[model samples]
Target: MIRFLTYPLVILFLILTAVQVPQVFTNALASWQIYTPLIGGVLGYFVLSIIPFVSRNREHMITFSHEMTHWVFSLLFFRKLYSFQVESDNTGSITHSGGRIGEMFISLSPYCVPLFTVILLLVRHMVSRDYLVGFDVALGVTLGFHIGCFINYTGLYQSDIRNVGIFRSLVFIIGFWLFFAILILLSLKSDMYVACKGIFLRYWDTLVSFWQFVKGLL
Candidate 1:
């Protein structure tokens, strides 16, 4: 059942965070740098996707994705959903009830996390670690979908942002995204420890050097 899956999913999330978060902290760029090609494609797709004619028709898709993201987190956290809806004109909402942590994730997910990409990554992870050929294409497209929809929807004021203070919203969204980004990067690489250490030693040294130079100037 869906509820049963939540237990496993939570474990998976924690395991990933344990390895990837510290790795990213030591070397933040490693989390995203390897995805440069795929990210470029995703960004390029975003440019083409935002043309009014292209975007207008896809409004419903965007709206559905937004609500579905909230719905997903709600389900993942075992929250109760009262209702979910998406209109033809790219407008939608989901009503759910849960604890503070779940409430934050359910309300703020649309702006920060890409549910489709996360879902795709999960599907890929479950099926085969190394057998997924051309997985990058699927990953890029869903990532583009997330970026495009995130840009369009977040331009307006949403009730979700108001519920969580703007500062808290950015911190939560960014911190959550960084955690998973590291996980995604680790999965793509053969040497995760090297990647993690790269962040800590190489990047840390560069940062320290930069700081020392700045101090000399002062």
Candidate 2:
């Protein structure tokens, strides 16, 4: 069952974080320069989370991106969007009643794409050490944009399909953070690296399918 797999991943994440925390603190003490990337990423996530309370306009812009993510995925899978809407509360959904697989892809695409993109950009900037001054601001902008769209659009928080208990919730959080860490590691490789190329290709295929589907509709 999903629960069985979820708990162990959570436990593993907790163990990893426990092991990493001291190292993170030690590195921070050694040099703020070394720790700026981590700080920037955390700050970025925090700022994006608060956009919902700022203004309707900001929320709507994020909502537009969220829906577009779905639309893109839908077209990638060659699914027709029967209808779609971005509401005033910054919520949006695309209806592809005929394409169950396409709908699933649309739902999952945002989770992988935006999260990975931000992690990649942050890691590249960190390693280059070229934009240390604006790292946090850049991170905040990207994180805010993605997180705002994620919370507004995804069923992760709202749907009843996955009734994650306290332990599971903790595990889910840990898994998400660990995934980000993995993404950072992956981003360190050259663009031609197998792992990097594989991920990009998969997303590209999905995106292309979504685009083609949209074009067909038009």
Candidate 3:
């Protein structure tokens, strides 16, 4: 019941977030501090792609990250993880106790959340400003790794997507992916609180404008 009802809201979330991309890009580019790491991350992604040995070795890491994301979310929802396995073929699985609502978050989160990237972001706060450029480069590398893995592995045929329903999975995946990506970009300019506030305020303004437009249509 609740699962079914969330579909529309997820779609609306996607639409609203998509509309913010241009403004996010403009702000990200306006500062070298922000754009430098963005460039580094892009380069890091390509570097990972072009090196066959490195890419192959990183497969296990990608698979582990995916399953770990499931495990983490499951724990958040108080579900017990019974088993976790990463296979040689670059695929993995987690067997966990689940509720109907929890399944949606646990199953779909790997596609939306980049665990390693989040870890790297957390690490950023601990580093001294003197080495931030280098640290940001490393952060970029992890993010690049995340984006590359997501592109290569995610598909309509994926069990995670199928389990949650394809349309809903895609809406949550793309929407939250963009949401997190934008937050990450915004973080380059300020701390997480400020970044989140900025994005949410923008979202609120957009939502209000949308409501006004809908009212005008009648």
Candidate 4:
């Protein structure tokens, strides 16, 4: 049961990052309206996916947050921590004999926490007007999180479950495609900074609450 959800989520993330292939090339060819940043993001995601070893050794602060969800839940439920393995394929998993809810929580933790963090960072970058820093930080943080998850937790090395599953994979692909599409469209007609500010303001409260919660944990 846990496998059902876990596999699909990982697969979805993989697909989301992988599906930018055509868009990447198309934008590259049309250098006049180049979506270089978007292309770079897509390429960066792919590079991380292909080269698992690179992501394995790097430190991912966000994973600390993500894994904490699992760790905390496990302890709350009084589940034993059996073993921690970081696989070559770039996924980490914690094995225990039982505890259904605990396993489910561990599997789903990334979606709630890591995804939110990635979105927040992306929005921040879009609104900042500091294009170089914004792009690099957003790309680096987002990619780092994904790579970190793959390398440190999901056990993508020894298992084929690195990619989540078909349905979730499609969702991730579509989600990223839409995200970049909107970003590119906004770039063409309006100042990205203004647009990003609008989004940031809309979600400011939620972001603040999330940060506060994280702070409390710290």
Candidate 5:
């Protein structure tokens, strides 16, 4: 019952975010080319992923990353945390007080988002353009780390996805990732700000047109 209901709600949430978050972003990058320093970061991330195959602590680190992401999302959603721990058996958990919706978001966030990636991206903003070389490297590294972690975590047993139902989880994940990606791009490319505004308008128009089409049949 709750699972089925969450489907439409997830769609509505995505539609709402798609129509709104892009509005506040007043910047965009001139180009999407991968900068050289970003390659450094990417390489670092790739190396880390491969190293895990031979490392003894890889499982523990991944578990820690997963749990830490939960904690981060908990904090972001205004949740109060009473405890968090990572066990030697490569298991971890967090106890936090939050709304049901917030709890749902917290559980699934790590799967779609790499907390470290966001942290590095945020840190990149603080550095000057003159120093962006280093920042880009860090960005690539974090991006790669996100990719690696996402790949590893997706197949393993995930309580988050099961709780929401896989179909709904995938829908929400797509929406969440799309929203964040657009937001990030818009924040970098100010020139596209106007186009960004038009984007959701077109999307809404399409939805409205579809609804009308459906109604004409009935």
Candidate 6:
């Protein structure tokens, strides 16, 4: 029942994100101070990816991050985390008990959340202004790793997407990716509060325009 109701919201979210694409890209491209390091980080991932050792070892990071995301969301929803395990083959599992909504989040979050990015964002203020570019480089590297691994990990056959339904999962993931990208760009320009406010205003404006379009159709 909840899933049924969630479909429209997810679709609407996708639409709202799509509408904000211009602004997000504009913001992202506007600052060389931000984008330069980010691009360097992304390129660093690609360079590391070509190395046999780094490529092989990355499985551990990927699997750990995947299951950890599940575990973290499980905690967020106050679910008990049971056994967590990562295999030698770049596969992992997290057992947690939770409500249906929480279950959905736990299952699907790793695909969209970028766990390391969140960690960096939290501790970002700790770094001095001079080393901020270094931090952004790290951010970019993690983002590159996440994007690279996400493509390698998630798919139609994956239990997480299958359990949630593929269409819904894709919509949810894409929406969150755009949403997070906007947040990341905004963060580059301003503080967290301002970034959040920017997101809210963008979403609110898009929602209002959408509402008016629907009313006109009616």
What's the best-to-worst order under TM-score? 6, 3, 5, 1, 2, 4
Write one digit per residue (lDDT tens) for candidate 4, span 54-152. 545544434445555556556767888887655544445666556655454444445433453345544544564656544644554464455455445
The lowest-lDDT stretch of 10 consecutive residues in candidate 3 is 30-39
User: Sort by lDDT, best first: what order?
Assistant: 6, 3, 5, 1, 2, 4
Q: Model 1: residues >4 Å from true position, as ranges? A: 1-37, 40-44, 47-54, 98-101, 126-133, 190-218
TM-score of each model, in listed order: 0.64, 0.48, 0.88, 0.33, 0.70, 0.91
Clashes of each: 3, 6, 0, 22, 12, 0
Q: Write the per-residue lDDT of candidate 1 for residues 21-105, one digit (tens) a residue.
A: 6645465464666566556657666776778986776778788888898899899899899999887666788887767456667
lDDT of 3 by residue, 7-42 (tens): 888898898899999888787778756558657876
Q: How far in Å is the alpha carbon of 77 misplaced in model 3?
A: 1.9
Flag the better candidate by lDDT, 1 or 6: 6
Put down candidate 2 lDDT per residue, 1-218, tens digits, no spaces: 64466567557555544444454345446665543555576566666556766553676766676667667777888887787899877677777645434343355455434643555464653454566446545654565566655555445564421444545554554445544444433433322144445444544665577689999999
Maximum-TM-score candidate: 6
| Candidate 6 lDDT tens digits, 90-140 | 778988776866667788899998888878877776788999899989998
* Local distance difference test, candidate 6: 0.84
Looking at candidate 3, what is the lDDT of residue 198? 88
Q: After superposition on all CA atoms, how large is the RMSD of candidate 2? A: 12.8
Model 1: C-alpha RMSD to truth? 9.8
In order, candidate lDDTs are 0.66, 0.55, 0.83, 0.50, 0.70, 0.84
- Cα error, candidate 6, residue 45 (Å): 1.7
Among all windows of 10 consecutive residues in model 4, the one with the lowest summed lDDT is 154-163
Output the TM-score of candidate 3. 0.88
lDDT of 5 by residue, 54-107 (tens): 356777877888889999889989989999999999998999885755766787
Clashing pairs in 2: 44-140, 48-144, 75-209, 75-210, 76-209, 76-210
Which pairs of residues have clashing backbones in candidate 1?
Answer: 26-199, 26-200, 27-199
